[model samples]
Target: MDPQHHDYTADPHLHASHPVEENKPSVWKKLGGGSLSISIIVHAILLAVGVVWIFQIIPATEQKVDFMPKGGGGGSPGVKEVSNKKQRATMTNPNTPRMAAKGVASTFTLPEPDAASSMSSVGSLSSGGLSGGLGGSGSGGGRGDGHGTGFGSGTGPGLGGGAGTMSPFGMVNPNANAMIGVFFDTKQDPKRKPTDMTPEKLRDVIKEFTNQGWNERSLENKYYKADQKLYQTRVYMPVMSANEAPKAFNCEKEVQPSRWLVIYRGDVVAPKSGKFRFVGAGDDVLAVRFNKKNIFDHGYTQGTTALYVPGKVDVLAGKKEDREVERIIRGGAMRVPVTLYKYDTTANWNNALGGVAVGPEFDVTAGSTYPIEILISEIPGGLFGAALMIQEEGATYQKASTGSPILPLFRTDGSLPDAKGKDNAPPFDSQGAVWKISPTSRRDI
Candidate 1:
């Protein structure tokens, strides 16, 4: 057999005949029978490589990377960022207390921990006092270490140096001997006589006293002799407001005309030898009658009459003419006119001022100096008559007698006296007979 064709017949069992030319082998065809061993070796290598890839290599290639940098992020870790809304809420609603039911925002503004706690308490004080209380702590505390936030170094708002301690009204004049109180008594008791009062009947005395600047009413026995020029006292009844007419005693309801002003009448004395007579000549005498109810008998009497020494004195005699005979009196009788101070909504006159007198008139000024005169005289019908001369610098005077100088001066610019005709006279306590003088109209000389 030929060497190339020898196997074809020798393996007749494996092959039926020789292959056709169209099915002949390509260039990469098997060279010999040993090629089967080479194929077996290549397949075994690929199987081993696949086992290593699945079990070991893939897990090693995948990794997790960390991106966080060095220093702690955004200040201290737990420091909370306060919103503008929260800051404003704390400032505006500082007065409100904390409650569980309220929103978290509202509770934050309230005193921390507890709302009803006292600011002065040792625990709270050490922690930080309330907003307005004394020795308070820094506002917006625990925010920063004295940094951008305004609160720092243990200080509160408006608490730096030069802050004022006293209120505006607390500043008082050192030299001024101002009236701080007043007293009044209307009961007829001889032991209660006050010397400062002019000799006159006690009738209609409350009305007469109230005509002056005594805005208080019905003083107690203890205050009848208070030594101060004018005592500081509050009235039981509400007086008229500053804007209302000063002459009217606002007893809260109506201007009760029967109310009168009162002061410590110095030492009421009985006439010594000479009989108490009218100021005028014998025939021109005046008989005075006083209503006991209207009169405060603390230092005055209903029938008491001061001896009239009519010698062109500051007080003149009431003319014995057409109507009720009257006597004139000057404000010099009582040096400084008694003054009255009003109270705010809650004031106890008896507790604060000790006592008060009712019915004295006052000067009508918003906040101006007041010059008031009180007249003490006798009325023909046995009444003790009084008239008040309340003159305001720029405003109209209330209950001023006729010919009593009305001076209109500007308080702001310190303007000089600009009086015409009747007002030409120097401003003085030139009060005249007030008897038969109506509360409103009559202004007599």
Candidate 2:
């Protein structure tokens, strides 16, 4: 048979019969092609696949990932890895202390305890007026005694029975042990001082605390006495939870009274003098009175009240202003703060009663009237012995009523327990004398 004629492709069955039996040779050699060249070609194809995977496929897959969560889905998995790397880099930066953000909260250092003592020493060294060392005054009422709950309560004047000795209308003595500070508006003009009080100067100062029921005659009049005075001294307005008055006279049985301070502004003749009094409308005046137990007892009840000038005055001709400041005067307490709302007709006074207004019921059947209101500020003790009101105006507006000398009311010892107890003590000395507070001094460190 010719080698070309006996073709391997044409005679599959005949070729099988003449099988080559070289089983001992390597498997690669058994094949027709050289083993080295075939192996090289296979390696080249694998290398190309690896290069595409590392350089092209991996980077392209990384760019297509979505790291952050979107539309609240299951969340992206692969993108989070790259985000974590960035966060780590930011945390390790040395130039930034924590996060280099300007809006970070700051820490404040507490003043050393010695700083307070040093300030006290400096106050003692000053030449200004000094308040003598008078013990505090205390007002106490006990509830639930041998008689019954809220029954048989006995209340004494002052904390240590000192109120009886001090006149309600009298000014607290300047040399008393208690400390007092007064700030009044007297310098309505730039070229004046508050202490430089002439008749006109005093009028200006009075108007600062109260812009109702003020007049030139009232300012100059010495005979107005305490009744005609717009703001009474040492008065508090209190509101009771219920209408039932405190039955006991003791410190505990007595509760807060529902009361308010009504102020009127404008000129009126002195109660003693029938003269026109050269009074102007729109005068500053504070109206303060106790409920039920005379104008002296500062008890109050929680109810709606209106404070306004009942009488009509010319609005353009210096119309007088009237205000109603609410306060709560509980037994054993000192001062009360009243709110003076700006005159408004559209305001809902009904909503404001319990929410904003703190005083007792004052009849205001007439609708849409302007009034001032004040809330009660609780200060322990019956009287603030060291009370001062320095008249100042123009330089500083006398927005607060407690700082006026004419007001007679003052803040008591700052630390006062809500209810009387063993810790309770008087704000002034046991003698029930007048007091003056040491002047305040400021130094920049």
Candidate 3:
């Protein structure tokens, strides 16, 4: 028995244990044995496949993408491109007329055409032979015919005709008279009545007062003479308001608190002959005499008719009155005498007298002219004055008449003086005095 040469055929277990293995080549040995480029190519292909497989297995990251316009000019500078979906939704076929937009109607229908006979009568409408459209020109009694001129007339004076008759003409002078106001001072006596200071007494006192000389007087006589002397001497306008007496005579203090008198003398030239009305108002007494007749007299209690102060006495207490008298006169100038008297026994704040004689309704054929005089006096005076206005009867005093005075008579010093050298007379006729004129001669009818 040799140890090195053991019999293998005898042991089946030993043969099973030492089984033969096949000699497959290693990966590096096979790679080393192939051509370099071919091996490289094969390896690269394998690597590329492996990389692609690995990329597909892992999740890929997203990247941004920008789409460009077809023409390459880009979009309009300021305009934004609307989405294709919106454009398709709003688009209409060019060949077909669109009735409305997408949301308006699901289906469109065409309208039926009108029958030809419906418009066949259009040429028959016409306006008969009328002028200016609407109705004919001479329809409503107007002067014009459709083709001719209308009625046209000339202008005339007054309403319907050129002028009418029965209008007064010319104006008398307002400042024709020369007025003198003489003021006298009287003692204040509370017990004195208006009757106590009568016109007779005032006349007698005035005579004595004017006769008093400046010389030969005792101490007591000096006081009496001084007290009785005329306090003021001045010319006054014939027309005066009650309040104007003080300014006209310079006797504001003397007139209201004392006694006074005034005389106005003038010549009135009546423009024509007609009935005349003498109207007057006074606080005490008012009288008027024309053509030597006592035309008006309203003493404190002696007249049948009286105009009392509105609120003073309920039954004509005689404190104040407005009186009037009417008379007939011939044409031409004549004398007019006016007398105004006031007795301030009640110490009233208002003390004055005034009157106006609507001038005669003169006959157009008669001459025109007259005289005027006025005498105004006040006794126991608290306030006193008078005024007289003369206008034609039934004829309003015309601002344009020749006798009208344009400017006021008051001087710069508030004194009303008589007409100086030349008087500035106003035209007497106003618009109310309308006169008809002869169409031929153009003279007043």
Candidate 4:
């Protein structure tokens, strides 16, 4: 025992009070395993918090639903890739306003919107203005900005008055001034114009066409209707000998000159109560109807005097109308054979410039309105001319150089002299008496 004395001598007093611990795991180590234990603890705390929020707290408040569009995926929010047909914006008006019923009209074009409505409509642009009052917001509006898909900055295939705006009549000229000239496009139909048509055939065609296939009982119908022309203040186109064409009043270009027929119908007021007669002429054909009664019918053709004679219409002084009267030799009456507007009568078939025919007398009171119709036909499509002169019985007129009276020009408005005859007609005399137009006239009884 005394030889190995150092075995237990060193830490006897320290070990007596505190015992040495063993190399084993602690209780905290048993609870906290590793990083996995820490991760599990964190997830458990989060799940507990989430359960409290969903089941206990959230149930007491109003829930807001956020609906996501379904797609070809896992029922998540996404955009749908599909297509559908687009349609035009039709005209519609709200007659009965409700969630189910809205009065929809199909009229695409409207002159203007309804003023008697508090709401608006959707349609084509207006023509002029509304009949009721000013204008409301139609498809576009009355030349203003409007609401509802007038194809404003919305995304769709909606039609707005096309692109900008459209006129009512496409390409039409609704003008009003003097007489209305109804033009018949006879050249459009080959039967109306034949290949081998002569002056006689042309004359017959014109008569039949103007008569709506020649109803000899009367000469007015609604068979041949075409474009119209409203002559200026007066229709004093005395002649169209040089193939001058009538231009469109709206457009600047010349149109519809030859190979057509036109019937000028309007009211003409008598300036004075006297025995008045129509001294008219034409190259192919010229006929006048006063008060719906045929007054004169004559033309430069084979049978000039054999046309229909209606009412008091007759050959003036019972003489030939196709031949011009050689009145004098010089300036003085019954003195010299002075030529008036005719130097080479042979060039135009010895006619009075355009072929004169004095009609019968028709009594008209002053300031009275009477319907007058003048028809001029250009059948051959070559050179054409027409004129209308007036003569009052017992009224003395100054004689021309040819000793014939420089008669008054029958017209509805004022006259502007074309001395050089450049407008496809003979030079007119503005100084002569001019017949004027009247607005109101009684219909034929």
Q: Cα RMSD to native, each candidate?
A: 26.1, 25.5, 34.7, 19.4
- Global lDDT of each model? 0.24, 0.23, 0.29, 0.42
What range of 10 consecutive residues in model 3 has the weakest lDDT sum? 164-173
- Give the top-scoring candidate (TM-score): 4
Against the correct fold, how does model 2 do in TM-score? 0.18
Q: What lDDT is reached at residue 147 by model 2?
A: 17
Question: On residues 1-445, what C-alpha lDDT tens digit does candidate 2 reach at each position?
Answer: 8886767767888888886878487776777558678888999999999997888745432223222222111123333344665444432331221212244344522222221111000111111111111111112222211111111111222111122212211122321222211211222222222333343433333323233322324332322111212111231221212111111111112223111112221111111211110000011122222211111111112111212222211111123332223221222111133222221220222123211111222322222121222212111213111111111122233222322112112222121112122111111111211212212321100
Best by lDDT: 4
Which candidate model has the greater lDDT, 1 or 4? 4
Please provide TM-scores, in order, for all candidate models, with all chains considered together: 0.20, 0.18, 0.27, 0.45
> Is candidate 1 or 2 superior in TM-score?
1
lDDT, candidate 2, equals: 0.23
Give Cα distance to truth, residue 175, candidate 3, Å: 7.4
Residue-level lDDT of model 4, residues 1-445, one tens digit each, is 5755654446587557776688999777787668678899999999999988878755553332322111111122221222121011111222222122125343322122233222332332222211111223343332223331122211111222223221211111121224555554443342333244344555556555444422322322322234334343333443343233322222112234455555666677777787887765565567777776666554553112324222112232233332233221011111111112321222252243322455667898888878777676665565666656777888887765444565667765442433253332333345655456664542221
TM-score-sorted candidate list, best first? 4, 3, 1, 2
Kindly give the number of clashing pairs for every candidate.
Answer: 46, 79, 28, 9
lDDT of 2 at 255: 29
If both were scored by lDDT, which would come out higher, candidate 3 or candidate 4?
Answer: 4
Which TM-score value belongs to model 3?
0.27
lDDT of 1 by residue, 1-445 (tens): 6776766555876576655467767555655546867888999999998998889855643232211111111212222353555534444433333333322233232212321221220111111111122222332222212211111212332111112111000111111111122223232222444434322434434334444433333334322321212211111112222211112111212221222233311111111112111110010111211121122111122112232323321122122221211222221121112222222211232223211212222222232222221222222322122211123333333323432233221111111111123211223222321111112321111
